[model samples]
Target: MNPPADADSPARQIDARIAALGDWRGETLARMRALVHEAGPEVIETVKWGGVPVWEHAGILCTGETYKAVVKLTFARGAALDDPTGLFNASLEGNTRRAIDIREGETPDADAFKALVRAAAALNASKRKPARR
Candidate 1:
């Protein structure tokens, strides 16, 4: 079996993925990734589900998915978070998740998005399991 990926490998892989995309999708995902990090400096990055870039702090904060026409940021527990800025425009029908879909030539509100990221990180920390003795 292949050796497990090192702790830093995920970040490298994500960089490669963004580079491979080489388009607006790559640029969008990169920008969102930077925003997530800025919002939660303690956030962890990992590659899961065959190449999705996931960010977590205590638990999953969100996943960045790219498509031909849109780059989507889906929060893990978005339905529970308050979105006063109304950034969520997709996956509204879901009970536990909400998503912001950014289309080509469209720009997301950076301040609001960062606030959402911080909130998501806090929510994940709140739900963390206690350490066992």
Candidate 2:
């Protein structure tokens, strides 16, 4: 039997996932991660659902789910945010979540995506109560 895999930290696990993909999906996931950081520097990255990358500020901002054909970025509070650029396409029927599915040879508008990230962060912050001293 093969030896057990090294126990990597969540960020490193996310890095390993991107590197293991080694295709357009990897590139897309990497790009998406960068945009999340650029858009919301305060947000922290975490691994969830057996390896999915999740970005959180005051709460969950979004999740990075990579599949064979597309990389889906699902914003937790997406349905509550505005999408003037019409970035959200998939998961539209949902009331709380919205997703942007990026397939091979497609690129998301960085500015619009960043706007959504910021809006999600703001929404999360608004829901938090100030710390009592």
Best by lDDT, which number?
2
Per-residue accuracy of model 2 over 9-45 as CA lDDT, tens digit each: 6677888899999999999999999999899877788
Clash totals, every prediction: 0, 0
Q: What is the C-alpha RMSD of each candidate to the true structure, in Å?
A: 4.1, 5.1
Worst 10 residues of 1 by lDDT: 1-10
Give model 2's clash tally.
0
Residue 119, model 2: Cα distance from true site in angstroms = 0.4
lDDT of each: 0.91, 0.92
Error of 1 at 127 (Å): 1.0
